[model samples]
Target chain A: MNKLSRVLGVVRNQLATYVPRINATTQAAVAPTADPKVPAPAKDKHEGLMEFFDVKENWTTNEVRVGRSWRKEELRIKSNQDLHKLWYVLLKERNMLLTMQHEMNEKWEPFQSPERIDKVHESMVNLEEVVRERNRAYYLLETGETGERPGRVETNKVGMHYFFKASEHVVPPEHNNHWFKKFGCNRREVAKFRLYYNEKIWLGRLKEKNRNTRHVMKLYKRFPDLDEEALQAEYPDVNLERVKRWNGAQGHFMPRNL
Target chain B: MSTRWYPIYQRGNPQLRVFLPNFWMKLVRPEHKQPENIVRFITPTQMSDHDIKQYLEKIYKVEVASVKSKIKEGLIKRQRFRGYIIKEPDYREAMITLPPGQTFKFPDISTEKEKRDDDEIKKFQDAASQSFDKFKEMNKDRPGVPGWFSV
Candidate 1:
């Protein structure tokens, strides 16, 4: 009983300090109340087609101020139900912006805050990413495999590897002659191409290696006092000792190492 | 599942559900006069008649009795200076019929715009007159001299 009371005392102290700190933070963040003379914005009363426009008062205004997009961290804390409702809100907002933009384009009037579209798009993207994360976690807990569609790297007709996302097909792969004819290339031609392609890549790499070796030798010949350890670190593939022994490494100045 | 993905519809499989639909529909003024009950919309090219009906009915809570959509091919015009053909993006327009009692009309937004522009012009004129008065006062000391000479 005594130990329980002691633990409660610590929690009580934490609550007392933490609650006041949170209150202070909120108070500091909130703006001061508007003057009594200034009228508060009227609630949105528009419906249907009218919803596609900004409020009547804002029609002629040169600038319209809006808040920033919802951050991913802020959205992740919301419940799935709240996120679902927010999705509809964002969708409607996007549609309204698009409609307003279209009308403005027709009339040659400047649309206020064009970034509003981007903000809504960003919020929607973040919401989707958060939902995807939750879905992945839930699926991982329930099923071993990710709920996402299965895909694999496969060679295309152009002989390039591409990720092929598997989808449900009425006809199985073996039975689908159209799929085989479209994606399959001539075996002999593909083999020859692959061999030549690999040789080209290998030659390019060999050239680069030789270039680095020659560059390192040149550097040593010009700057005898150059930091050999630093040069070795910079080009790990080059044999520094072998380069130092090369005749081209000799310079007019006596070697600094000697 | 996302709205972007669609699995092949098998006869016995349960109906697919779109949890996050990202399609956008914009209400546009009709190029030609439309009936009071008819509303025009520009939707994503991929939207079908059924999709348009469901989108409005479900998302906007607007009753859509019917939906007819047609793709307007973008205009291709050759640039006079650059000698290149420029094509506008193709768009699909949908005409939706509302319930019997409902009617919609596009509001005129430019009526108040002219009044606002007049106010702005008046303000600019006032500033210009005030600056001209200041210039006159500055030149009063040296009569018949050009304004640029004093500056």
Candidate 2:
């Protein structure tokens, strides 16, 4: 509690220093604060809606300069509540950028500093990763399970495997008409497809090996003084001595010793 | 960090709350005229009307009267020279009705200052062109000579 209060006090002091200096004209346009002595109850919640758009000053500028995303180390020290609040802050920032980008697209003007969206997205991702780490740790300590959604790898009709995240349905899968209708295909078709896919992959590898062997022979034939160790390192799968013995290794020019 | 994963929802269990909802929403200009209190938005196709309502009310603290949404098909057109058809991704648009006595106007962002900035650039270019012409005129009489050869 003491630490929480200290943190809150620091935040309040920062806001107290920041808010009053807001441009007088913009302040008049915004809702009036209740008391000058204490912070004005965080302004009305409804006014938070406007935060989904860039500030007026930024709307006119061709470029908006911003700092880099929050690093994982910086977020790790913050309390969960602070992280939650910051998530909303970044959420608002993302929405604002999206809104501006859409508007600019409609007007056919380039959106300024498009990477700002990526920075906000990176910070949010890092913040979520940190929260998930904490959540996993707590769950494991208390219940011996990671508090994440259960999922399983399953093959689709197209013979591709994907992670199927399990979720509840009002009707169980056995009775669910749509689930049963869309579930699988004939087993023979899958087996055939898998065989053909494996065959193609094997052929591709064989062709690549032959190509590399030919290339190595050409390299030796063209440059008789070339280092053998580097050539072996490059094509470890192909035997350099075998390549050198190949008929292609005999060049039109006279041998290096002659 | 796995964004697509969500826990099963059961009748008796606590509601599955999204602590870090990664879905995004953008306020967009309405295609047609809307009421003073109505604002249009473009959101991910997977978002439902309830999700939009909850997102605005809980996250933004805006009082929403109702939300209606529809998915619009993106245009598919042929490239002029290449003759290949290019298709745009489909988008979902939500119409949010705010409670009475609220109004939102999409602010005009760039036009006012753009003209002034363009004029300033044009003036600078003109001055630069005049100075370059003067320099070239001075060098015209002595062909194939270095610039520092003369004063």
Candidate 3:
């Protein structure tokens, strides 16, 4: 049964490799709503459309007071298409608020309720997560790997040791001179940076050794029956026998080693 | 559109088209006033002058004459007893020149803002002063007892 399951898993993974990612077609299909007659999109897509576009409620009133942001869980069930459309709506709303805010600032008037933008941002993030959740679910069903960008640790020029996620470069790594100059970590970098880097590494090691030596001496004074081999094993660089004879390591009575 | 991770496109590969770019640009009140067309913006710092131009022209359908941008560092202050300095987030401010015809007016946020802040502060003071009055009332008959331990 185990062997059969293993073979089935391999077959699924192999098949996933062959299937094309939904990139081009997905982009084309989800293009702008050309059909002006197509009755307003479902509620999620048009959630903020009616109210936010214009100050329809109180056109004369300069400020539009609003409530709090939408919670994440409330939006988690929404579809991808709705989330996509909603993103544009939010983008437009933000721009409108900005325009309103700019005019207020110029007139030396106080900009009302700046937190409205924050609430909209909060809603957009929740909406994005909802879409991502569905994408993850679909990807898990179709492919073993997450359909999102694959990330891994990579060394860069600074040699400070940072994690860099490899990304899709338009040119291949070798041919891409700009990428090589900026991002790529070559043998020359490893050689140049490694010398000081190794020195820094050894300095850290020395500090650890000294700290362990002091700790072991303190341990010897309190617990006379402390296992010497295990102590040495725990800190390979620390000498257990010498730590026992230190003045601070002496207990109230005669020395345990003597 | 000009984020670090996305590819730097050349002429060919079906062009990385943005049906609706999700970048948000807010027109903030500039600390100092200049021309009427030069509108200030609070935007992501990575956005370039070109990005802002495309953003207004493509998304808002507004015509832009020109754009210039700069990053402003927020205030840095040390908190009491925290032993660490906290700096407010850095923000990008853009000055975009709109076409000759268009004029924008920013709405006043502080009409209700002042009232809300004043009321909140007043409530806090009332709560504090009321608690003090209650303490005095409870202690009126117990003059001999010490203030700290009597309660």
Count of backbone clashes for each model? Answer: 0, 0, 9
**Interface RMSD score of each model:** 3.8, 4.3, 9.4
Against the reference, the lDDT scores of all candidates come to 0.76, 0.76, 0.62
- List candidate 3 stretches off by more than 4 Å: A1-72, A88-122, A136-147, A155-162, A168-196, A222-248, A254-258, B1-5, B19-22, B30-38, B48-50, B53-93, B97-101, B108-151
lDDT for each residue of candidate 2 in B104-128, tens digit (9 for 90 to 100): 7666766743664688789999999
Give the lowest summed-lDDT range of ten residues in model 2 chain B: B1-10
In order, what fnat does every candidate score? Answer: 0.47, 0.51, 0.26
- Give me the runs in candidate 2 sitting further than 4 Å from their true place: A1-49, A150-181, A253-258, B1-4, B115-151
Candidate with more favorable, higher TM-score: 2 or 3: 2
User: By how many angstroms RMSD does model 2 differ from the true structure?
Assistant: 6.8
True contacts kept of 1: 0.47
Query: All candidates' TM-scores?
Result: 0.74, 0.75, 0.54
- For candidate 3, lDDT tens digit of each residue in B100-133? 7555443344454455657878989999999989
